[model samples]
Target: MVFIRATQSSSDIACIAVAPLSIQPFGVEPTDFDAFWTQQKQTLAQIPINPRLTLLNTLPSGAKVFLLELDNIDNRKVYAYLSVPAGTGPFPAVISLPAFGDAPVQPEPLIMTDFAERCNSINLYISAHNAPPNLPDPNAYKPDDLSKKDGFYARTMIMAGIRAIDYLSTRPDFNGSLGVSGMSQGGGWTIQLAGLDKRISAAMPINPAFCEQDGWRFERASGFPNYVLVGRNLNVDSNKTLTNMRYYDAVHFMKRYRGALMFQVGYEDDVTPAATQLAAYNKYRGNSTLLTMRERGHTYPFDEYFLGRYAFFEQHLIGFKNPFNFKAKFLADAGNDRTVKDTAVLEPQFLVNNEKNKVSNIQWAKIEGTGNVGFQTENGKTVARFSQKGKYLLRVSADFDYKLADPSVASYYTLTDFVTLDVGESSNIDVCDSDKEAPNFSNCPQNIALTTMGTSALANWTPPTVADNCGTPSVSSNFLPSQSFPIGATKVIYRATDSKQNTAECSFSVIVTKGDSSTPPSKNDLAISLTSVVTTPRPHSFTTFKVKINNKSARTFTDIKIQIPFPSGIVTGGAATSTLGEWKEWCSNNDQCFTWLIPQLLKNDEAIL
Candidate 1:
């Protein structure tokens, strides 16, 4: 049923709306953004985890520190300081990133060994650069071709961080859980590593750098490594450099993350500004906490606020809890009020502040007016059936159970939220009364225009992920990927429908155009390839054709149309399945003839099917 919270007197109840702060993103991301990073990780995976560790020293708290090195992408090396607890135990791991431009040898007393000892976990304090600590070389990354995406220095640093995580996971003493943290440049790395790598279940990025690198487009201050002046060093085209830097922008990454994030931003800090980091926090749908220290600027918070990070990690990584105050709250939201028929389907959510803590069980009870109310779990949701048509108040409670290191210590919390349901006589609107919210669609593809290779271009895109408060939503699309889009503009609509029949839709346009052949395709503009495979049998033979179209022209091509003859074996007048183009048969000199329509494709997209 729809949840309606009971209210008090008119004088007591007040509603206020405040506009949220957001850092609007600018610039362009490559069409192959996700694919590019996936390829980089794959490249890293191909290289072996040639790890070497040397004992450095041991703290009084029985924490041993060691110097570690590992092989990264392209046979490059990554250096770090590894710290572990004294026990012969398998512990959760954390890979700490370093500050920008300054590669110090010691990652210790700062946050490495201290964190390991406090949480009793393994700590791999790593450097962002290829060279070892204490040796700060500006040219460690060979930042000459910084104007290009693939050749950017930030990409290399991220790859090195990936290698560090790879090395830590291989240790026998390392537990399955892993995390990342950093300050300034390292803070930016922390967010990037956590967002880029799913292995990191928890992250603490403090005054992070490299976020919203292009915020200067609107004359606004950006996070660390502000690319405004950095662009001059590029000494290249400003537009091209802006496009290239988008790949390294931290804001783009956090938008897709949903894990536990311990993010901090400074109010007065000139680098990694408060607005930028808060913008990142707002974009992420996760268990996250943002601490905006008033006087803090590009540095660690005071001991009181700083110590909370350790407690946060302890609760998340080590399953230990002193206080469950890490900015997030244990919540049990019963949702809005509803008037339904006899059966009421309720989808109550149970969320915990720390990952280590578990939601043991959820109990639904009728606290007020009710007549023989029965409860049952259907498809993982609580359903209530009332015998009589009356108003009933329900309290759905969830327990946040903590797993303690010491069994003797007691740790647990219960959170409950209320919802009211009105039961009417049996009717067809049973599902409607229970659900009133529509599914939300995210990651919807941006509108794209494509240059037609033949009659049509095979346009493909990753479907958007949906979220609904009710239940698992089923998605439908107007266009099937198997079919081809003909010339001109085609709107691809994707719809998501929940179990209750509530629906939502999102769409993007695919425009196709024929280009002018008079002006030859630039060297970096177009790439088109075609391949055919055939099979012959005693009775019949079949040929399969595949064509790939890529548009990196940075501008649309218009004017000329090109078409390859449709395959001949199919039944005429029926349908000849071509994944890449439309089949329009014409009455020509022969039995039949067909030509594919060409259209203008987008600047940076490619299509295979």
Candidate 2:
């Protein structure tokens, strides 16, 4: 198909004006994110380009709202409009990337209002030139050569985002501290800029797409025309291109991005597969967090209401208290099959009390008007009371927060630092509020017991029963009394207990031999084994000696202990070896089998005589 172009020429460039807003600093400093970006080098530029400036609207508060356009100066000029709080000697700056769809898009007036009035932060809506006079018809932009590498329109739009950052930095009143964020395509671009750009201190990407390509959709999902166009444009060399593109891929780049990030995804999403998103999430090796929506999908408010998604940006971008910071993730319920349940145990050290920085305490505690909830104690220990069960969100407040011991800290932010726990089958949830100053574990009660083994008829010892809040308890095992016996065995009994204090004892009997049964392998038949008898007495001059053995069905030979009586004491010798195949040698002077070989003989499939 031959492509047609329409051009609109006017010497005038539409400008976005900055709102006179108060910029608040999050008080956080920039972090080093070298290894993170190293993995995403192929898909990203070492330095971002494209800068433009324009005026938008005038606020009723007598503040001028301006837009700064960052063009992807390499080829296509992607534009991002930045709105700053006018008049100042450098105020904190916030750069916003637009959501997926068209470019040069403006946000809801309320969002702009929040950025200007409430957040006192600069705002930007960097969009692709997909609209009117400046852009080709959306339908005209097809996946072809020119549009792939040199003209992937969305990539150019992202270039505009970079330029917005440059433009914001040049402002006399713009502080170096910066924040970048967006949803969907904007989210993808935000993550890229946060990882590739050194100037941003924090980033928030909500309901991000393009996390995993091959992971789920195999290629691209239906209707999404952006990335396919990019791949085609880059003329991605079949073999080497994918290898190289892996570096530019968002999932790959996430590994190197150092800016603190708050990523949100939905579990029931049909659009972006959870597995693919999780693959990208796993690559983010920074001061970051992951929030999951159980019954949500790819929608607007749903993405916004996704737990910590908005709060992450509120704290990182606009400098506000994070509503989701409770410390210690006690309840991780991915209602559908998509839940991540790898929660480990929460350590006790996080319960300490500090009285200094209320900020640190807030980091540890959940302030509920009157008081806080957690293990709060001035001494060394903290004990909180739990009245009911269910999923409980715990928050800990501490005065002081301590730095990690060393670089060995794989996760700087502990799951235990903010937690959610499910209590009671009907009431089993008991959440704990912890602090970053202590040890943290995400999900506790991680079932690590061996569930299955190869042996079909093997005896599975019952898992030791566990009870809580009963102090340190002990466990002991007991075997049933046995007497001298013959073949025809019935049962063998064993018991386990934790003694008197709320002790639970379990007694079970295993049958060694079964003549015939319709049930085949019953519980008793499974735990024990009985094989044909082999009589190999210690060597004697005559070879065989008669020993009286009683066979009583009522007496039950299962627990019967037979004494190997020696008529002339035991003497290690010959013929006995021939009678016994691999059977172990008997003890000299004592007509008894070798104690060490009991395990071996028990497993040999031969019956003990």
Candidate 3:
């Protein structure tokens, strides 16, 4: 539903339209990175406690699943199913854990299989040993199995995953990058192992269960069952347990750990809750990405979502490129122009250049309205995640209606500005208004005037100190070498607003050039490489060998001229050269063959003879 809020008096009326979620969506623009992150932290402060869950799963390749048992450092045997892939060499591996269930019923064998195929890594599953293990000590698997204080399950299992990596290192085929993943309770442990174990290069935890647990009373029957079981065994107070669990919580642990992580969440899910998942996410300051489902439940869009997750781990963790790294394009709403609403979509390429020395992630926010908003991959197809509040287009489209009613009648309201994701500090852009018309500057002055006064290679320039009615004016420059100006983009785009609130833009380029009169070469370690070629008759007059000097005083420089001094016959002149390009000179050789003439030079000017 959309409405327009208008201020009207007899002769004139102004309208600002209100649109539903379908036409306008809310999100932080890239300029809001700091604010958004700050908000996330503030939210975390409100909910201080964390939750818990226990998970178990099968690791496999049907060829032959074996009950492989291993002992931890404490010598307690831990049971696991090891599934070796069909490859010849040592394969990369991932230890899989399933969401909490009392029994290892329908073990998520398929996901483990996918792990092998997708990641080309070995899969090891540590089953949730619900029943008591046949042990010498009755306390091992009892109702209050506090065998080793806070129990050995956490440390032992994490070590088991590390051991798998060690075992992988033994095989000649292993590449040595370990990735860990799990969902629900599994997600919690995956986080734990990833943080505590330095071996894990990548980790993905989906719909995790260990964050902000003040509300989820899992001690009750219908609550998250895995939390209940863990609470019962560990004698933990589920409500106040999170504060003590901080040492064990993956979220807190990540602060001390650094590496790659991928988090997934369901916006509509109350189970692990998107906000709580984000709480864990916000705690992580390392390299990571989040994939969230807006209208989905706790049961994620596993096939497509997990497939993407595996692909991400394979590329970043395993250093593998996708076979279908193709290009596709789509259009999105930039708002309306004429009868057609202006739109913008990602350029039709699935991949952009991987930024040098920077971490980047691509995300699409849902936009509501008649025209649809979503991300458009390089492939021409559109993926729409259903929404009850409004319609969404994964990317901008061409078929959107251009005709808008009255002075302003928008179908949706934009809550947050679109983030401009770019490299470095240049990622900030302006908040655009849909109803406003673009400034008309097709006939403005095209000439650009730029000048520099310092010895520094015109590194960069701040926009001209200028302002307009809107307050201060701002602009950006695209710098290039002098030779590349204009064509190479030595231009600046200036944006200004008038007293009447009218905006105008102008562009100009500087005609840059190299400085005149090259600075002479210096005489550093300038020993005679070879002797002089003096024509007989005009014997090079060995006159006053005073060091020729210049007036360029920028920085102090030492110059030495080692000359093959000649007294009489075969006259020769010593030339000056420099390893550090600076001012220098050539003078007559004096007395001895090794008589060295050296002089210190300053910046900008040079010496000669």
Tens digit of per-residue lDDT, candidate 1, span 284-307: 644444454544456764542356
Ranked by lDDT, the better of candidates 1 and 2 is: 1
CA shift of 220, model 1, Å: 2.3
RMSD, one per candidate, in order: 23.5, 23.6, 27.6
Off by over 4 Å in 1: 1-18, 21-23, 107-110, 319-609
Which portions of model 2 show Cα errors greater than 4 Å?
A: 1-52, 103-110, 130-158, 216-241, 300-314, 317-609
Question: Candidates' lDDT values, in order?
Answer: 0.66, 0.41, 0.43
Q: Compose the digit string of candidate 3's lDDT tens values, residues 457-520.
A: 2222333333331223333334432322321225556665543456666666554333332444
Best by TM-score: 1
TM-score, cand. 2: 0.44
Give the range where candidate 2 is weakest over 10 consecutive residues by summed lDDT. Answer: 17-26
**Top candidate when judged by lDDT against the true structure:** 1
lDDT of candidate 2 over 219-270, digit per residue (tens): 4332122343455566754443233333334664465576676666554445
Q: Which of the predicted structures, 1 or 3, would earn the higher TM-score when compared with the native?
A: 1
